[model samples]
Target: MGGEIKQIFEILETNARATPEQISTMTGIPAAEVEKTIKKAEKERTILKYKTAINWSKLGEEQVWALIEVKVVPQRGVGFDAIAERIYRFPEARSVYLVSGTYDLAILVVGKTMQEVALFVAEKLAPLETVQGTVTHFLLKRYKEDGEILEGEEGIKRLPVSP
Candidate 1:
C-alpha cells in the first residue's frame, strides 16, 4: 500500500475500464510499472474484480432490495463467522457483513418483487438455527450507490432577492 500502488488502486476504483497506460499517465508512473503493479494486486486478491455500476431504474426493470438486520447467537468457539458463512452462502444474500450495534449481521438481499424478498426472509432467513431475530427494511429508492449518482447531477439554483 505504498503511495504509487494506492494511487493506482484509487484511479482503477473510479474507472475499472482504465488501461494501465491511462493510469500511468494520471499517476506519473511508467506504464510497465503500472501494469506490473496491477497484475500483482490481482494475484494477491487486492483487486477483486472489475465491475460496472448500473442505474437499473433507467432500464424500467423492477427490482426489490432489502437490508436485513440479524441478531444471531454466536456459536461456542466459532463465534459469528460460522453463522455469517451460512447466511452468505444463499444466492439471495448479495452482501453480508458482521456489524457493530444492535444486530450481529447486516445482509443486503435482492428479489424481483417485494413479496419474493419477504418470502425469502420468512422461509429462508428466519428459520436458521443461529438466527435470533431479524428486522428487514426495504429500499424505496437509491439516489447514490458506490459513489455514483443514479439520478443525473442537478445544477444549483438560488431564488432572487429584491431590496
Candidate 2:
C-alpha cells in the first residue's frame, strides 16, 4: 500500500492530469490498483483536487492576476476559517492561503482587467468587516506552472560535449 501510494503521488506530482492507465503503465501496477489507490488518496485528503493549467495570456482574455496580502481580525471564537471562507467565495479569487508575517492571508485573484481587479479589491475584499488592510501585486509573467514551461513547448536542451 505504501509503495502504491508513493508511486501514485510521484506520478501526480510530475503530471497532475495523468490518467490512471498511464500511472499503472509507468509504475507497472494494475489499473484497478491505481484506481483504488487514487480513491484512497482522495479520501485521505492527500489528493485534494484535479486541475488544468491554462495559458491565459495566449487566450487574449485581457486577464490580470494579482497576489493580495490581507490582514484580517479573526472572530472571537471562529478563528481565520470564517474570514477565509468569505474571501474564497469570491469568483475572482483563484487561491488563498494562511501565511506567517505581517499578513494573515494571501489571496490570488484574476480579473478581466486591472480596473476590474482593483474594483474587486477595493469594493469587495477591502470592505469586509474582518479585513484590516490589503496589498496587491499583479503578476507580469510566469516562468513555469505545474512543472511545465510557459514560454514554449521545447524541453531543456543540452550542449554537445566531446568524448
Candidate 3:
C-alpha cells in the first residue's frame, strides 16, 4: 500500500463520516482518488464496517455487557475456527476472537438485562460440546470506550507556564 492510501485509511478509521472532499483536503490527495481508494477498500473488505461508538447510557437505555473467556477443544482439522464461528453466530455475541493464555477464545456479549446475559452463558455457551469451560465478567461501568471519554472531563489538564 502507498503512503497516501495508508494516510487515507487512518483518516477514515478516525472519522468514518469524513467526506472524500474533506479527506482530500486533509491528505492533499485528489477527491476522485480518495473516493476511488475508499471504494476499492470497501469492495476488497479491507474496510469491514463503518461503525459509531454509542454511549447508550446517555439515552437512558442501559445495556448489560460481559466478556467471556472460553476454553475450547479444537477440532482436529479446523482447529479453533469452527468453534469460534459457532459461538460468534449468536446474536448476543458482539465480538469474538481466538486468543492465547488460559482461554482459547474471548467473546464480547451484550444483553438487555443481567439475567439475560447470564442465561446465555449457562444455556447456550457452556453446554456446547467443544466448550470446556467459560468465565464471564460483567462490565459494571464504562469510563471510556473506543478511545472516547464517557464521563468526567474530556480535556487535558496542563500546568501553568512560568514566565
- Most lDDT-accurate candidate: 3
User: All models: lDDT?
Assistant: 0.93, 0.90, 0.93
Tens-place lDDT per residue, model 3, 39-124, is: 99899999999999888898999799999999999999999999998999999999999998988999999999999999999999
lDDT of model 2 at position 157: 82
- On a 0 to 100 scale, what is the lDDT of residue 18 in model 2? 93
The order by descending lDDT is 3, 1, 2
Higher-ranked by lDDT: 2 or 3 = 3
RMSD of 2: 2.9
Give Cα distance to truth, residue 139, candidate 3, Å. 1.0
Write the residue-wise lDDT of candidate 2 on 81-117 in tens digits: 9999999999899999999999999999988889999
The C-alpha TM-scores of every prediction are: 0.91, 0.82, 0.92
Where does candidate 3 stray beyond 4 Å? 156-163
Candidate 2 residue runs with Cα over 4 Å from true position? 42-46, 152-163
Question: Which 10-residue window in model 3 sums to the lowest lDDT?
Answer: 153-162
What's the residue-level lDDT of 20 in candidate 3? 96
